[model samples]
Target: MLAAGSGAVPPVVWVPVVAWCVAWQASLQHEVIHGHPTPSVSFNRWIAGPPLALWLSYDRYRATHLQHHVDERLTDPLDDPESFYVTERDWQAAGPVGRLVLWSLNTLVGRLVLGPPWTVVRFALSEARAVWRGDPTRRRDWIRHGVATALVAIVIDLGFGVPLWLYALAVVWPATSLMLLRSFAEHRLAADPAHRSAIVESSGPLAWLFLSNNLHALHHERPGLPWFVLPKIYRANRETVLERNGGYRLSGYAEVARRWLVTPRDHPRHPGRAS
Candidate 1:
């Protein structure tokens, strides 16, 4: 940011750089939720505090993500907060426009271009509803995240001498898009829990940016392991992990894009969850 402000690096260049930083920050926040690099819960929490998240609060994400780890409920449309699929009731409630939007979101191109804004709006509304329902925890989290986002905005405008709109367009949106890439088809609804999560063997810069979450199945299988060690462990247990997950793997994000860019991978409605 300083480089960009000082005109040392062009804004065009810094845009992607800042975006990558924010996206990597999210992966670090993921580590925080899982108790990584330290044993002290307080330390872990504060260490990765303030996700600079334009959408969800850290506490809110933490609570829901922990619940999402329950293997039995991996793709439970109603139960999993991160689930891409929706229940039949949810589909019916969406009407037509909402249904079409859901359909678009399931495609790779749509997810890259449209997912961030949709997630922001949807999650904000959900959080606001929770606050209206007298959830004090949600209230506090919202307030804190609101303050944090404001501080970041200030830094961008005042300290860095960059326009707020530029910051959002350059930094925030791209970061969210990058995250969407990793999560695009990250999981599938399967009878076996192990088969639900996917392995994206993309060892490119994104692998590091995502903190090795490309090895997602291993992360799920050993939630306690730190990101740095995932590759080593996965390599050692490759056959076993592959067998366990029933070969739920992909080559990389490139493959994901090739396969699902225009076509939807699956319907928005969850299979076997219609009732």
Candidate 2:
């Protein structure tokens, strides 16, 4: 169907078929990060290294995401590099518009609407600075990422004859939507590290869609456990995990949307940031 849409055959009857392909590819990348589909790390990386998620490199994401499993300081502003909330120091460093952007990004709606532009631009500029500073490893990662991105561009241009902007709208935009839903209510910067992760219980369709990432606390506790095994482990150890997490819970994404659709879950201030 997607091949047909790419003009390989004829335009298929399905509109969302391509969107589902993009989403599945993103999920495959997530699995690869956890060292699944095979034990050979190189093979796994090769399988997941496509620029389907755009600016993020699989190697860099794997490194950072593994570090995020450091349960002692899961959402600490200084420790967790993946943290979205800005520290007080960071907020002070930014000017007025920057601060406003930061605050807006803390909410789900803002994150979805503005996140792609913010992330791509910020990362590109940061990488440029790192290269200018002669950071060897950063340069290497960026080079690899650029190569992958170029290949993606060539495929779209040659294979589909689709303009870059149209390709982004077709592929990147929907993929970002799925990614946003996965990370939407995954964490909170609580005082205790165990309590940092949020459980979106009774997730129906999205459970498989997110690769059972809704059972986030279980993943944090046992990062080595495979995605297929997460549901089993979560069910067996539900009480213990919840007890450790101080009973923090939401009924599901629907409840999450209802409660925090308009409200901000956390402020621009990092919970751990000190004056």
Which candidate should be chosen as best, given TM-score against the real structure? 1
Which parts of model 1 are misplaced by more than 4 Å? 6-8
Q: Which ten residues in a row have the lowest lDDT in candidate 1?
A: 49-58
lDDT, candidate 1, equals 0.86
Ten contiguous residues minimizing lDDT sum, candidate 2: 10-19
Evaluated at residue 28, the lDDT of candidate 1 is 90
TM-scores vs. true structure, each candidate: 0.94, 0.88
Model 1 lDDT tens row, 1-275: 88788889997788888899889988998998888879898898887855564665788889889989998998887778788788888899999999998999999999988998987887778778889999999889888888887887788789988888877777888899998899887899788898999999889899999999889888899999999999999889988998998899998888998999989999899976875
Candidate 2 similarity to native, TM-score: 0.88
lDDT of each: 0.86, 0.73
